[model samples]
Target: MDLFKSFSTLAKAVPLACLAFGAQAETWKYAIEVSQGDIQDLYAQEFKKRIEAKTDGDVKVNIFYGGTLGTSADATELVADGALQFANISLGHLGSFVPEIQLFSIPFILSENNEVNKHLMTDSTTVYQGMEKGFAKTGLRLMSIYSEGEDAWAANRAVRTPEDLNNFKMRILVSPLQVEAFKDLGSSPTPLPFGEVYGALQLKMIDGVGQPISSVYQSNFFEVTDYLISARHQLFTSAIITGDDWFDGLPTERQQLIRDTMTEVTHYMMDEVPRLEQEFLAKILQEKPAMTYISLNEVQRDAFRARAEQTRQKFVQMVGSHGQQVLDGFLAERDRLEQQLN
Candidate 1:
């Protein structure tokens, strides 16, 4: 009788122990491979803070920065597999799904803050739902979009005209849109990883690269590239994501808590990115003081813009039925948002 009583008591304690540990589970782990200086890192910090504040110790968020967990491509796969609870990665590198994200790298649709913002914030046929759909099928998700600053061309020499670009070799990501755009302008684009870019430029393999000014500053590309064109070619962004299975398994309240906190985190991220963008652009001038910053004349700007138009048409065809509608829907939604902005 005594042994039976002891066994029953132990069995009852097992469930209690499990509940106790569950109550004290630390914050979720968030991974961003970018440096502490990057916007995604800032967002991760804000998310950690907000989730902790709201959950009152029930949840804590742990973070890793500077590719500590994995490269961006690997991060996406890991997050989908539920090996990672959360991550922020560039949609560009996740070519296995969300192919429409490539449209951002296109020369026109995402070339400016207003246009990109319109795409993200505006409501219409343009919520990137297809991206959400495709990611769902693969066990990843779309949590939020982190702001990436406007892009520019940094070169060894002053690139004043289309003719100047044609004579130069540039590093471009191997996306179809980028290849076609560079080819259209007469420059041959070589696809290389961001880490490899500095070496390529040093070895005279590439005469220039198109990138955000802040990225140029962070990587110290200003040393090799003597000039910058505030080309603002595209507004870049990263996707915050989590394992779909993990997200689906969470209690409804916990899901809401995370969603709400992440929104606050996004605001902090939005403010921080633009602030850093301006700071770096200004620093580039103040620090080096000798590097030329190219401001395109209105006529030159229009010429580049004109060349980008056909590329949009190309995207519709390239993305096929799903992406074609996304293209059409985005354009109409973009027009509406621009109207609201005006």
Candidate 2:
């Protein structure tokens, strides 16, 4: 009788111990607007892996991909409300919430040189210092901003000059700056949801889209488009963000771990992007042999560059003096980085 009672007590204690262990583990929810294997997904996965490993499984990240939880806008709100722990959203989409973010959408604002652009995105004070307060005001902790690739135009027709884009209905992010920028280039800018882009192109709802080369290939936009124009007008930048309150509530050590891990991931992404751009473009061509690739010469690109000033003026007008200050700082940083690189 004594032995049986001891055995029963041991079984009960074992389950209690297991329950306590499970209760101590933390599960963080991460949201991304792209499907698995996309650049953002890769970033989220790497972050999840690093955090979990560093925490020794005390923290686990559950990623909700392809807007499984909701759209990018919805996910942003969820993060701000503390319903989600993290989200990777493009600056274009974020412009609606924080208009100052539109600085990034201005035409040719970033350097064409990959190294300069990488440093601007990763290490620039304009983003980490200048824009951090704007993000915090909206209840988000801006963790890191990184680029996927230079934004390219995928169209049904070849475009070599600004005149070639006349009346070209282009699918743009729902950003006022993008609308004005494309308008300056003589294209009718149509703001559409990212998911609806491929179908809209197939159904002829829009003419072309400006996106990173990887997105064009990963989303299979190449199937519906005929030409890939290497415009290099802007870099496709995305930010990793979390709820301001949630991040602040964490222990100081955990916060430092997250910051350090994100910096590592940012560097990882910068290195991976150049290789991915080449691989994705090759795959796009292999699958679409009839597709044309157009690389505009400097003289041809100079035409588009001239019109960028008009868009920059419009950006300052929309965001006002604060926007101008941020823009000035960003331009100064870009210039410094370019000079250093040269």
Candidate 3:
């Protein structure tokens, strides 16, 4: 009778002990190297919320925003090495590590229709799959890929045609494709770090910077530049990435949770981008009435597109045959989806 009572008591206490130990939750740190008011910051905060709630606090996300960790490049390195668990990285920053990524940055590669964003999300999209596969080889998993809007020209003078771009020194991302594309378009592409761009523009070191309207608004470039031309050139694609080793180490359910949560965030950002573009443009119009905001007509847009096409081979040569295969697959898928949409 005494032994039976003792065994029953021990079994009851086992549950309590398990609960106590289980209280120690799995924690992760997410790093964002951009400014606070940007869309990526918003996505990080919401991502934290969703992960915690969905996991019922079993998993916790700690967000370090505004380069609290380090510069964007530093953060990306940390994430790739698994020192940082997650990061939101611009495609340009990723090209050096995964040359195949440079394909997406090629000028005028993506369609203007917002639905093109949605099409890339499908699992069967060849280029998207290829990029994800390529990223895997570099030890990074691409959780989400979406547009933050298109790149625009923020110049001291209005740039209406290719001639206007001649002799113009423009700030570009560090991607070679960007340099080649702008060079073909008759501008002197000056690749500069994001931090140096504002001072460079103010000092007339560079004549203009190419970025999205949201970026111009966030970076306060509108105060320094007099023209905003909607190039819609290069749909700026960004990816949410995590270290493959770290992700793979997680429980299967946790992996799925993160993937699903990020997918939801990507879709939300896609819808948010155009609206934010309008918001930023409206603010620019109201505050800087003298700033010229020009939207290109079909003929002008075609001219820019034709020039961009000339840079495609340059990108292919940079990445070689494998990269060309990815580009061809993406173009075919893009065309197929576009036709279905029409």
Among these predictions, the greatest lDDT belongs to 2
Models 1 onward score TM values of 0.86, 0.92, 0.91
Residue-wise C-alpha lDDT for candidate 1, range 250-316, written one tens digit per residue = 9999887877676666665665777788888888888888989998887876677777777777777
| Global lDDT of each candidate | 0.73, 0.87, 0.82
- Prediction-by-prediction clash tally: 3, 0, 0
lDDT of 2 by residue, 80-120 (tens): 99999999998888887778888888888888777787677
What does the lDDT read for residue 303 in candidate 1? 74
Question: For residues 223-304, could you state the per-residue lDDT of candidate 3 as single tens digits?
Answer: 9989999867777677788998888898898788887888787777788888998998999889999999999888988788
Candidate 3 versus truth, CA RMSD in Å, comes to: 2.9
Error of 2 at 325 (Å): 1.5
Q: Rank the candidates by lDDT, best first.
A: 2, 3, 1
Which regions of candidate 3 fall more than 4 Å away from where they truly are? 1-22, 121-124
Clashing pairs in 1: 27-60, 27-61, 33-67
Model 1 CA lDDT for position 233: 51
Worst 10 residues of 1 by lDDT: 118-127
